[model samples]
Target: MDGPGHGDAALSAPTLTAREAGLVGCRQCTRVCEAADERCPRCGARLSSRDPGALQRVWAWWLAGALLFIPANTYPMLITSTVGRASEATIVGGVIELLHYGSYGVAGIVFFASVMIPVGKFVAIAYLAILVQRGHRTKPKHLLHLFEFVEWIGRWSMIDVFVVAILVALVQFDLIATINPGIAAVCFALSVVFTMLSALSFDSRAIWDRIKTLSND
Candidate 1:
């Protein structure tokens, strides 16, 4: 007649945030110390629940990454020289060529990794930055999860750069065929790096701070 855990349902475990508990966690070593403490004893890093310039740094890097991303997709990513002929391929063109060659799986992987992932990261990072900056209290937990996902996926976005690097290094044939990385490769690499820095500069604790503020109000 009773639901699962019905006997313990009335007993609630209240959640307490570090700020609510008068604690500050070191960003470097995650050492918990009293909020009154000026620095973390374990790592000696300055402790703060929220970074005042977090959004500014995040926006700066985000803008740089977004700007570089335009040229990265527009220009050729690779230049292949075969005998007397030379061909250049942009990111989309490269994927299309792979598909034309019946390498569907490889093409899909390239398209997803090179195009979709980067764009998605840009959108996700922008969304998180805006939400935190605006101090939106709606679904703070979900926003925190989104921030973590963006951070986790940041490194993987460099797959295209890695592939280009490997090809530029391994595919060398004097008179037969040779592959060289194009300008877009540099732009794309820089875009990935900037976006990664943007994600790293973001302070996820800001999301919870907004939530706590709203709760207290």
Candidate 2:
């Protein structure tokens, strides 16, 4: 009733080839086949997992982007001018202005889509990366839940980009309420994109696999 040993022969072990080795435990969910489902008993990938370094790289980008995002949100992202006089607005300031002007919908949307979501994504992704780097079994299940949340919120963090795009494209009426996106917008946009890429590139199975191997060793 016991399983085959690690290198034991005559047991017909499910060995993976070179290329397929990296994709060892990744199998269909059998219910809904998506980009996920790293474990599959039917596919014999249950023991095979992912690359541990992948999680470390993901965290590097995430933590760095989070650092950049702090300033991006704090600094002025838009400068508006009329009669050669200008007013600057950080993200929070812009939100408040919108609310003051009775643009509650715009303000609410900006606050959630841009401010809250980006910050939340950074924090969540960083935490997951840290957990994986620990490389120990009995891992926090909530980290997986947080990872799911990070994936779900990743795309929505591009609201700042959309806002900038719209402003640069539509607000071309010079001599009126002109809008020029500042340095902060570019940095913020890049932070969101890079963090998103980092999260997607990460492989959680790799972390767990390394942990399992080390623990076995």
Candidate 3:
């Protein structure tokens, strides 16, 4: 039999994972450390190759967010009271009203941020969580990119809450008209917060681990 050569081993060398190399990456700071270390030196955060309860936490928060999203859409987001008239408008209703008033730009923005973005985030988070849990190795890089995109866009999802706050503050008139945030504002804000928590609780390293497994195979 021919002796093992450099070319034969070279192909497998590049796929060696950090754990196999006797190293672990800090989850908080992304610093490489000896696997024996219990804590990250730089950030003082606990060191773990992967979060033990990541999927559980992600699922819990995701469920809460999904539940709250219902009321956020059904209940009124803004209550407008004038001298003798009153009206309640949910997020979609407010967007429609803005469109009817010919403020197309604002209407589109509200619809995109309030309706489209939140729904998209819920779906994306759930998808990422499921993929990571299943250890599905296909398109690992693309999945990581999707997770990062989800985290990056999370803050912007609060645009609706910000709009409600601004209107409540600036559109107050004692006798003429007043705009007040409704129950949906709280529900929507809570839903956004829970979804954000879910995204953060996910361990992106899980995606890479699956990639590493495939490469080794």
lDDT-superior candidate, 1 or 3: 1
Per-residue alpha-carbon lDDT of candidate 2 for residues 66-144, written as tens digits (9 for 90 to 100): 8888888878888888667888988888889899999999899889987788877876776666656656565645556
Task: State TM-scores per candidate.
Answer: 0.87, 0.69, 0.88
Candidate that beats the other on lDDT, 2 or 3, i.e. the better one: 3
* Deviating ranges (above 4 Å) for candidate 3: 1-15, 214-217
Q: How many residue pairs clash in each candidate?
A: 0, 4, 0
lDDT of 1 at 3: 58
Off by over 4 Å in 2: 1-49, 135-141, 206-217
Give the per-residue lDDT of model 3 (tens digit) for 77-133: 999999969899999999999999999999998898888878888899888877766
Q: Write the per-residue lDDT of candidate 1 for residues 67-94, one digit (tens) a residue.
A: 9999999999999999979999999999
Residue 145 C-alpha lDDT in model 1: 85
True-structure lDDT of candidate 1: 0.87
The lDDT of model 2 is 0.70
Better of 1 and 2 by lDDT: 1
RMSD of each: 4.0, 9.1, 6.3
